[model samples]
Target: MLPCPLPVFKGKNCRFDSCPSHESPPSSLLPSLLSELGVWTALLFSVESRLQKGQLLSLVPSQLAAFCCFSENQELKIMSGKPILHYFNGRGRMESVRWLLAAAGVEFEEKILKSAEDFENLVKGGNLMYQQVPMVEIDGLNLVQTRAILKYIAAKYNLYGKDLKEKALIDMYVEGMRDLNEMIMHYPLCYPGEEEKNLNFILERATERFFPVYEKALKSHGKNYLVGNQMSWADIQLFEAILMVEELKSDILSAFPKLQEFKARMSKLPSIQKFLKPGSQRKEMDPMGLEEVKKIFKVDEDLFLKHMS
Candidate 1:
């Protein structure tokens, strides 16, 4: 039998199924390989030694290319048939995409860019279009745009709607959520002087205008999901958008009973539960700066409570 393509297994008994050229090593072997090769060095090895010994002579050109110096983590990821999601350390725009990925049960590697240098390198390497993040590398294709990525994953995992009209409705709902997001994203900096004004605008004008639309939509649908009696990309987007509002103000959604129930139901989903559990890629919910605003503006406690209420 041909030797296994893995370095540690290279010249030893090929423990993997179907010998060296199988689609993937057995899962039972993963613990040992991870220990021997380290995480990043997972599958790559110098094949020159194996070539001189004629161990890999049966491999095709494509197989040989895969066995080259490049890391096999990507290959293994492809073998697992899941995508790699690249985003900044913070949730930001990628939260919905992450939610969709989890809800769809698509295993994905989260590449968190924690520094400006890391982001710049990715942009300089031409991996990101227009130098923006929330990019996904899946099945040999790199995709950008949060909505597009979510749609692609949803379609892949069958989380999207069942028909064309259902898809259109899903798109419509997602667009509305994006509109609400745009309002809050208007001033991410939240300058101390404008913090109270911005909060008031969101509470009074934006909330008044947007929240009722969603509340009505939820009641009209009369389902746990936002669209078509099932979870879709739209549901995930709206959920994350509501989460952002919750982070900004704890009591914002109390008035909308249907939405409160909707949030509770989605949070209870198995995939969402796994995503929310500690030690995952999930980040702590930011207070969205009510306290920071009070401290920065030196506002009195009583006055702050009155404004927030």
Candidate 2:
């Protein structure tokens, strides 16, 4: 009733006409105090109430601490919301991340690196980890390395599986899918006269190697998903890998009935349904042979070819 010791708030009929300004708590002390106080909601409400009244209260130590805590908490809330994907506009390593998030029914935002400077800026910000794209900002951390990001998201969303055995199976299946996906991801970067050759190689590998693995898994399991009774990371990766192959050859699944059925069944999932529709985060293969990608990343044909090799 003594008009509240903190002078920033003028709640209801209370006024702080004579309250002395207290020195702000030391920066190191703020965190401990905030944790000990455990009154974030009350402090925030008081600040909001003051703001609503258009009263510009002079900053006192308590008010400064409250403001700082509120700002940091707000930032964490935002980072914990939608994930922010950083990559070139074209689909590359980040595409799998997109697919997994989509299938998990998690919406995300993208910071497409349209120029070298845009990428440099991220590196300068010190959040790019190994200075790589496909870096994701989520849950108050800048996550790098594609597999790590995927594993975290999958585990967070309950798609990793129920136990160690299931997770191991999912990992096995996903590794194979990653192998196939890497092939498809680099196919477009093939040398000028080697598109046909690369295309044939991808088809050969998919039919002779990758497709059969998943086909056999689905058939052997006799379930709707690849690794378990429920959908897991493997299922989403397989679904995405199937689509990537289909883009190259529409009838690629003709030989694998199980894969065909798996494709159909996966397409019916609500999350996958949303992703399949036009204008979703799902990206089309670069129409200009990823010319934009080359320009943005500043990679010449020789470099791409070398990387592919």
Candidate 3:
């Protein structure tokens, strides 16, 4: 039998372990060889039997190259499979994306940009289509634009609704939720002196305008979800907006019974429950997070106020 040519590891300290040139093939290489041959069960047994009785299992140069390529491709597949979110470490535009993915039970990783250089690096890498943060790398595509990313994720995860009309409704409801979320997301960035004023504006709009829309939808639909009977992108966005508003005004839902009931029902979902846990991917907008955002984006209260106006 020809000896195995594959590199063998011995003791921890052995750096140059080698097998005899005439010894039987090692059992370690059997699985890879069997897998490459495309006959796992029967061929694995055959190879195992041969190895047990000291048989020859010679692999040619082409076979070795193919196996190496297969291993490399598998490694690449694993490394690129999980979605990577690139953004500042806070609840900005990326927060809705996070909420949608969590609701869909998809696991993802975050590349938190802590400095201007980090953002620049993303732009340099040509990953950000519009040279912006809140870019998500998923399914071998680097998705940018908050709405585009949200729509892609929603459609991919079967949360966009079942048909065109349902999708249109989901889109309409989501657009309203987006407006409400934008207000709450920027609330922390306002000047300290204007904080109360800005918060009051957000609360008034949320309670009087946004919350009532969702409240009536839930009430009229008489369904657990907003658009359709099942959970959709609109439902996810509504839940996220509700929580963000509640952060500013805990009693905001008291007057909206249907929305209050919707909140309770959505909260009990396993995925939503997981996201609401203390250590999940869900991020909170706070003083520290706000500072991080300002530092990373090089924005000040004036810039935020001007942009809002």
Candidate 4:
């Protein structure tokens, strides 16, 4: 949208200097790395660069803001009559929140951030930058970060856990869901060198560490959902981890049959089913790199043998 002002730099080292520096890549991968670095810069520097390019980006509106701007201003800055959710089109992470809100019978608005500039505008607004997307702009205030937003909305809609103990348990699994979701969404973004290390780390921890935890948690609960008999944020988060994103191999779902069932069961929810409709994808500047990055997360192949060994 912004005419690619910050062109993606392939196969070259980034100037950020702040990001963890690796040894200079060989000649073959240099261009690719440079290009990927440009995208990395765009995402990482969006908030910082917002001011400099504010005017240019102002013309490029977010899906959420665009929807809001066209509509007449209501008495409430945001309307509870119809709940609104701001999401990036193809990035379906917010669908989990959509599912949660729908099941809770909340009516609201849904807005999507269509471009990098749209994201820039958001963070430029101070409070808008807190945790970034899956943001819930209540009334006029922007609530960033998914977990906190989810919890806040859940509580607002009375989806909170039954008791202190239940709340704690609900939170525990929800956090697990949160961590796993992040890992799945981002593991592929790491550079090739970083991928071998990071992917191996993720898989090992996922298998030896996190898997046992999930397996035990599911076994102990002995139920469909993560916490109690009812659905919670954990379900939304876990279901999303399996449902959304690009991958290296089969993803985290195939090995864990319980999680597979968890995903299948969640798919049956009307709200979640409705979310399957095509959403716009956040276009990547570093197209070549995005694929490679996505592949880092793909573990369907014998990654353990190749990288871990």
Candidate 5:
């Protein structure tokens, strides 16, 4: 039997392009054919497969290499090892941290936990979080809470700040964003119906408390990154925090024009933009939940929608 065609390309995992079966379209028909094809999932997968096969061919350990490459067990191992594990809630707090790790090109297994017990079992031993929404286990070490994980992963990936001052700045913004995110995530727990004497009392209290601090932080930093021009874990944390608030109660940001501009810049990031689109492994925010939160906060819903663009 003829083997599958090989396509050719290169990246961390998935090699379909290098398949031996891969063949160019007749030179004359290449451009028109490609234009008709648009994004080439099939061709790309083929290219990836061919590449993997080539790597297999290069294994020169004779008998052992031949057995491992030809056997089904090794292929199973390759498939299983492709993902790293991540534990999180669909809520923005954990989602933000999850997205950043992916943005940084980390491989992970994703575990979505809905209950408290799920969290407890997952934590090999708690280092930080009082709750379980976001946790990570890296090479036998388990970490709880979003910020702690972000800091360690960032430093490991060379995404953290360059110096002590920058790292300090990272901490400053992360703490601020964390405080705000906690309040926002917990908003529904204290919800009260409208016209029952006051509108969205719980949200009102949270907004009054958190937004002012966020505003001041923006003001203190002169509207750039918290520390320096380089992208730090802090920036990533802050960006995710703001997205939650924006998803929940957007008009809350109008009061802080600096933060609003920052939000705009953050949403445009190539990684973020692609992730927000349909079919990203990451999930999008709940539009109705956002609207409900806005109503609770008495924010300008129309203004918030304008920014979703």
Candidate 6:
């Protein structure tokens, strides 16, 4: 009834310090407050009623001009029809999707949540179809699941394949890369006293099991991609996974010459290069050191080593 008593507005150069809601509870508080079904529904009703009658112009705190401009621009953006990608502020399961979007040169909106509370707010609001992230809103459909989202975007851009056989091949490669990713996750890179054991397992078991498959695929595919001798969603998935492995072990790709070449090839692509550059959209890898883990977890080195051994 009182116009929600907050700005609830965002613009390119929004100045929050001078706004009445500047002292509003921590960012999470408002979302939590508005999340109540009754409260949010009422607020939305009021907002919608005002919007329909064009009486919303007089409801602002003297920032009417800015509000009007922001509203018009947002309408134009919505009318122009860009897809919206919703995910946490990490590359975990979204990098391949980002790659596909970037490579396809499609302009999409990113809703990158910065905190766990923000994600919970979305869940509480039922915005996510599966109550999980890495969801995307595109083509009038809200899609969930990383692989499904990636395949959908790729298919739209012709990166999935040109024929049934190629699609099957891409699926095979994508599944293999997923398995490889699972293996890479097994290494406790941050566990104290287990660094040696973890690194050894990574170098010995994981490398032995996964690297050769990728190497063979790259070799047979002419060193550019994993299937059809052209870029596909699988290639982007594998390349992004390789970047994660490199963050854990700098030399993970050293022994696999072909994989090394593949990394170089993928890195040189214009879309991927832009994605890798320093930016908020690019996922940050702040790997925890063994020493830090030792301190924080209070791990007894002797016991740890004995158990690991």
Q: State how far residue 182 of model 2 sits from its true place (Å).
A: 1.0
lDDT of 3 by residue, 50-163 (tens): 323212233232212111111211210012246789877777788899999999988889998888778777788987776766788875588888899999999988999899
Scored by TM-score, the top model is: 2
Show the lowest summed lDDT stretch of 10 residues, model 6. Answer: 60-69
Candidate 2 lDDT, 1-309, residue by residue in tens = 122234442223322245533333344544555465453322332422222322222232221222222221221111125788988776788889999999999889998887768877888999876766778877657898889999999998999999999999999999988988988987876778999999999999999998998888888868988877999999999999999999999999999999999999999999999999999988888858477666756778667532111
State the weakest 10-residue window (summed lDDT) of model 5: 62-71
TM-scores for candidates 1 onward, in order: 0.67, 0.76, 0.73, 0.55, 0.55, 0.62
Pairs with backbone N, CA or C atoms under 3 Å apart (clashes), candidate 6: none
Any runs in candidate 3 off by more than 4 Å, and if so which? 1-80, 304-309
Best by lDDT: 2
Over 66-107, each residue of candidate 5 has an lDDT whose tens digit, in order, gives 211211111311222222444433454556656676667554
- Provide the lowest-lDDT 10-residue window in model 4: 67-76
lDDT of 5 at 222: 73
Candidate 1: residue 177 Cα off by (Å): 1.0
C-alpha lDDT of residue 162 in model 2: 97
lDDT of 2 at 166: 94
Error (Å) of candidate 1 at residue 35 is 34
Clash numbers, per candidate: 0, 1, 0, 35, 31, 0
* Regions more than 4 Å wrong, model 2: 1-80, 287-289, 305-309
* RMSD in order of candidates: 10.6, 8.8, 10.4, 20.5, 13.8, 12.6
Clashing residue pairs found in predicted model 1 = none
Query: Which regions of candidate 6 are displaced past 4 Å?
Result: 1-80, 115-117, 185-195, 221-223, 287-309
CA error at residue 165 for candidate 6, angstroms? 1.5
Give the TM-score comparing model 5 with the true structure, all chains together.
Answer: 0.55
TM-score of model number 3: 0.73
Candidate lDDT scores, in order, read 0.63, 0.73, 0.71, 0.52, 0.52, 0.60
